[model samples]
Target: MDSYQENYQEEIEYLRKALAFIEEEVEKEAKNLEEKKSDLIAARKDMYENTIHASSDFESLVDINLHSMQINNYISSYNPQRFKNLKKMINSPYFGRFDFIEKGCSEKENIYIGLYNLMDRNTGRVYVYDWRAPISSIFYRYELGEVMYDTPAGISRGDVSLKRQYKIWNSKLKYFFDCSVRITDEILQEVLSQNTSAKMKNIIETIQKEQDIIIRDRDHELLIVQGTAGSGKTSIALHRIAFLLYEGLNSNLRSNEVVILSPNTVFSHYISSVLPELGEENVEQSVFDDLISEVFQGRFGEETRDMQLETLIHSRGKTSGEVRRQSIDFKGSRVFKQILDRLLWYYAHRLIPFEDVYYNGTILATRQQLKNRFLHNEIGIPMAKQLKIIETFLLKKVHPLQKKRLQRLEKIVEKSEGHEFEIKSFSRLLAIRQAVAFRERIRKFTIVDYRDLYMLLFKNHGLLLKLARGLTLPETNKEIILTTLQNLQKGQVHYEDYAPLLYLKLKIEGNDVVSGIKHVVIDEAQDYTPLQYEVFRILYNNATYTVLGDIRQTIEKTADGLLYDDISEILNKGKMIKLSLNKGYRSTCEINTFAQALLGEGTQQGYASIERHGEEPKVIPQETLEAMDRSIVEDIAKFTEQGYESIAVICKTQGEAEKVFGRLKKSVQLTLIKPRGGEVTKGPLVIPTYMAKGLEFDVVIGYDVSKENYVSDFDRQLLYITCTRALHRLVIYYKGDKSPLI
Candidate 1:
């Protein structure tokens, strides 16, 4: 055998020996733990059955407590999972290896990098280094020369003599590489060429230098990452979470202290396997609507962001569409935020606007009296807290009259002649009791909903006009406000209004600041407006943020290019650091080249060239809808027969998705993706374009790309989003003339 092959065989044999030893120890520990559990259970039973004498009671309690703690220690020490992880490492011991000689040290240190650290049990020396460890940076961030890495104490400079990667699987060495300056393309091409599964894979094994920088960053309070369509933005964000968890183990932080706000629930599930594979527990996960429900206490039937996205994708040319877009943009802007702040400040001291409280034809309290009381006391507390104080003051005045008022109403009911009069008297008594109890409810916080506040402003156009002057709002916004009021009257909420409402709610009902959240990582963050960022800042007041998004993929009109700039100012002054991931890591060069054309010339500046190459996307013209459907079915069957597991047929609107699914399901078995769809499963799937954001598939079939379907710039954005989701193949089918953009 060759020299390298002989060396690899020796390493494999050593790993197998280590694996056998670990497995044996794990079994012994498991047996010990079971015996300890049985002993603890018996001791608890004895403690419950024994009746201690008064003289021995103190001694008995102490013994039981001490015994319970000792049992816990035994259980803690008997964890077999660490050995189980070591057993897993036997198959693929390490991916990269390097020799580093420290500045003052003589002997060279050989570091082997893997998913998790493994140690020599007898010698207490690290046998395999975790990819996230400080010493592992030499494998990813340096060439075969001088290198330095930072530690808790300070920087450690060294000379990297050798850098090599191994592709070991199932305890066999498939290949090995000697990297000179950068990683060879052979490994990346092999990894990327594999078929994508339902779960996202951890990128630790082949994370690029750009991605490594983002994952290891912890010094910045706010990190704004603007990447192109396939730049691995979401992947890098998850890695960052994993890094924080590893770093948190030695500090005051915990895994649960970080939160990830994804674009959709399916996207959350898609990325659920990444952190666990990296040896960390899952963090908090939610979408924007869930966050709104959390803050609003799930009152007043709030609309979800998915439904709003569907509306934007389907409604393009109508007047309703225009007004909706206007409302979203206007309400999501900084100018409107200033208007909301003004309204909140003006009403903080006078939140309780009741005119008077009347009991038995006598005025117990007047509006002027309550106003004076509120203005005179607690001048600077939150509106919610201030209202609590007012409630206490008003209750003190109304309690004595409640008994007299109820007695008078009962007498009136007894003296009534007709049944109707008696019923009216009972109603009056109920109203009196409710009036007295209203203050009590206020003490528990039942403030008016944001719908009420928004409707009130619309009812008084003069007040809105006055607020508009402060921001130089265009005159056209007057119509937008009217349309929004109409929607609110029908009990429907616009996406743009959700944030402003939360802001108003916090201003009046006090901020419901959730504690213990040290970091908030947001994916598809360009979709968020300044108003939403304001709400996030208040909710997690002490949190650092990591925002990842692509401006080219901004399908919502509510978001603009200045979103990151506006948010940076709120996170911290000069503390927010901006990073860019320009290279496309998720798609092939051919796919990226076609997707790049969908954006404007200047809009593609942030995008970088990809290394992968594949077949260029094709635009096929057909004569009828039936013909297009037949072609898609045939293609899906062909792709599936060719061993493709995960495929998607993307449609422009929910209506189109449903129609296509109805037809496709009759001919072939496929899953339909809804706005509130569950986890995306394996096999052929039908989905709407908007719901397909932040997700990818092995093969994608664009149902229709006709001019009739894609007419506006927004429609083009949706098309851009759908086309980039394909990893290997893309086919666009149209009924009429081909789209000019294609």
Candidate 2:
């Protein structure tokens, strides 16, 4: 214990010394700012003296030879090395002829000036602008905007164009640009454009700590970072991309090649300004929902309308239609692709060739006890002999059924028979021949009639309509109506089931819309199923992927089961990595302790982890549900009064959230925050626990903990999410039994 105390004392001493060193640095900065201020004054005075003796035309009157001789004499009189650059700089284009109108020169502000741009006389190309020299002050503030930053030995003010257009060579590339700039977003009559002031405190002379670290680590393909809400995680991510690009230099990576999967449209808007601030163009940004919709376009009406986001807003539940769910699951995962393969096999064996017999409320097919349509005996023979079977069937089917009426129907059946060569021996030949003949017999088609096959599609139109709504049914009266209506139609378009590669042919032979991106990042990765990931893989084939999410936060029932099992399976097993962020940096120390206590041993799961500190967690036992609602209202008002940025009454499900929100909204008049839940508005917000996953509040009041609501495993995630949202404080109020999670 004595040694520990000594170590603590030593740590205090070290911190004290560090503080002193920082103070000394601050003093040095102050001294440097003063020196710069004096230099500005000297330059202004010298310019005033030159103006008094100036010539109307610079080259004709003021002797450049005399100025150079004076600068040379000063250089010889003093240390030649000390004033070399300054001497050369003083004789610049508008050479020491300008004076700053030193009105607003105050503490910490150093004003200076220099020659502006050096343009090629013949080519009119800008060679350089002394933007970094101590001469850019006139362009920064509103004080000296009227005068051109440089002077040609005169005191007369000059007008400068807001934009200067030019073409120049940057390395091997020839670039043209219009460089227009606003200093403080204002326009003046005679705006100055030369040099400006540099405040010492704001001067960044060295790379920042995080920037240095990011620049050095260039090899890691995947970077998993969990940081505090304001800890610059996003800032670093953008910079990391920029640094990789700068290093990629002449290599392959370009600004267009980088992709950032933002959380939402509003979030994309929020981050849109960051990259441009770093002097790099913004990369492609989108939500995972966009990719999902693109993948299921023709087959399903899958929307990036996030199920969780919808549930929160629409007061929904886990989808109740089992068949509909099966369809969604099939399409949303690679399993759907496999199911397509299976269906193709079914089509190949003619298992899908069912005929409606009005049995079991669905169309049914029955197999004949004998060959009712007859069969070609040469079917099982070798390929060479099989050709003979097709040839014989075609010759027989295509033969003039009636030699007298052969002209109209002759070539049609003959041509169709050749198209159905295998079908003739396959028993369906007679049915196809009859369906085709009946079509031609009914319609005046000296043309080829492809209507018989379309009969089945038109008959199933009702089912197709319902399917488009993402619905599945056992059987419906609409099917009968559809069949009756289809029977009345003479000719309709039909789809032929082409073995296993029906829709797949369209996909495979489809044009690949190349997305120009080298890297794709999915922020909430666990919410994606294996199929969504595959679609992303296909869409951005040339891009490396970086996926990030807390699987515990994967509260969507339709997500990767929150087990992340699909991602694990699809990523070739161990190619998938699992990370446990044991330390929670978001909440307060007290809140962290209570939450860990609430979570118990389950908190140790790889999917669920939180920092060790936050506002204290509480359980307020109320008198009744109404009283609980009232208590939350009072607490929310109190939090807002205390300057808490966000306050939410988080509940397990959307239904529960709505009930609580409805009651408390009336009692407390709390603001009903829309999906655009910005910084805590004027009042508290009522939000679903799931919707509040990546959000936080100054205080969160758990609405209830009844046995039916809070103790169930289904509510465990909601509880975790709400508990983690307390940036400063959290309170859980319940009327009945305690929550299991609590």
Candidate 3:
């Protein structure tokens, strides 16, 4: 037989053996688990029935303790996780394999890589190595040549004799490729050419060299990734979490200790399945707005970032929009951060009470003592905590004097002429009244609400001016302040104010750190302002961060979002490394080419397309809105018949999306994706551009690309985001003249 046929026969025999071994192991584990469960149940039953009266005697107590220990042992021994892993491996045990010969040894060993390690208990032989194993790094990082991998002992050098990748489904090898490169482009092209799905899948077998480097990096504490659209930033971040969990096996790192901050709820749902696919549980997922809402206990009405973007998009060129834009810019600026710092200083130095605290004409704590404690004793602490320290000190002083006074009154009452019982009752009532009065006095002086303090910045203009020294305020400063006060009065807060308000709250109320989170992943990092980064730094000071963003995809125009340099400066707690993923993999070359042109000149260098080609994006102009709608319906039908499952009709704003959905729902099956919360369903969908930030589809139809809708430079990113969501086809329909961006 030829070499190809010979290798195929060998692979088939190997698959049979692997399947048989997995089945046997699964049976063994199942038996062990059942025995352990029975032992635990019997032990518990015995302990409950016999130990009811064991506490009454020493010998009985000893028997009960023995039963308890037996139960604990049985419970700890009942592990069904291995059985589950074995069942998962029964169909497809491994995806890649390589034959390696050590530098000194003449013999070669075959290493099979899979989702989890598999071994033979009888012979102590490993059947497969987990993808995150140290030796598996060679499979991803090296070509067919001499390679070295780090082990617990040291570096081990070896030569790769053969490298092969397999695609096995239902215990059958569909195809296998013998590759001479790190990852064969044939496999990647095949994987990339498939249609889009509602949920993202794990890219384990086809991880590129650059992406594998990021996934396995353990040296840097802060990893910043600036990747273009379709560059697999989200995938890299998720795979990194799995690698960390595997590498930290002995260190007790858990899945729940890592948190991912996604763009929104739909995006969170979209990427939730990746970690579990890699044999790890999903980590904690949240958004910045959710964190803010949790901190405030949902007491205040807050505007969302998506809602703010929709307003800005819909109200372009209006006076109110300009005012709101200026307000957001000023609030998210460095000058505003400085102003907050000055305001904190003022609170520490000048906001203290100027009188001594006294009870019944006896001084408890002098004002100077309180000031000394607040300023000098509690150095480097939050002002709110410092005030708490002073309150505690004053209370300590009041307790002894109150006790002495009550003792003296009791003695006087005993010596007075009256019925003894009546006098005692009266004295007890008097003492209770005195105690209440004293506590009320202490409460009055020691309590300070941080909300009231924050409101002073807007209500007291003189204070704001004094704090804002040596800085240039925005031209609409007065209007901004007025708008803020009005929102506060109505129990509402603007989206841009969330960071500043939360930061100020942390400064005054002391940092409420979530100490358990060891790793934090911030997706779409370009959308966050500097102050928000600062807030994250303070809140998760102990966590290592992986921040991914692309500045070319920024759609928010109000806030001055932080770039890489600013982020490095703000979150610089340890060694930081920056990486870029320039290759676009989500869309075809034609789609990427058309989308890159929307970025204008200098920013187009951020991304390069792979060697995939498809139909070029088409911009179709119609005579009227009805005709445009009809054309869109026809195009959707054509794509659907062409086997495109996930199609999106992307609009500029939520209002526009609603109008389009209303007009098209009766004609076609449509699901409208709202800004706040919804599921991303397959098939044709109507969604706004901002809500479609981190999703992809097989076909995307831009609803209205008229100049009247997208009129400014700000809309370029929105249009680019809309077009880049397509994997195979992009169609733009406009009633009037096409947007200049197109």
Residue 110 lDDT, candidate 3, scale 0-100: 90
lDDT of 2 by residue, 669-701 (tens): 765433342333434767655556545456777
Per-residue CA lDDT of model 3 for 564-663, tens digit only, reads 8888888885799999999999999999999988877866754678788899889899999899888888988999999999999999988989999999
Q: Best to worst by lDDT, what's the order?
A: 3, 1, 2
What are the runs in model 1 whose C-alpha is more than 4 Å off? 17-25, 28-84, 295-298, 349-380, 393-450, 558-560
C-alpha lDDT (0 to 100) for residue 481 of candidate 2 = 37
Cα error of candidate 2 at position 600, Å? 4.4
- Error (Å) of candidate 1 at residue 391 is 2.8
Q: lDDT of each structure?
A: 0.77, 0.45, 0.84
lDDT of 1 by residue, 548-611 (tens): 9987788777455577788887666347788888887777788888888887687666567658
The 10-residue segment with the lowest total lDDT in model 2: 194-203
Clashing pairs in 3: none
Tell me which residue pairs clash in candidate 1.
Answer: none
Indicate whether candidate 2 or candidate 3 has the larger lDDT. Answer: 3
Model 2 spans with C-alpha error above 4 angstroms:
1-217, 220-252, 262-281, 291-337, 341-514, 557-580, 597-602, 605-615, 655-683
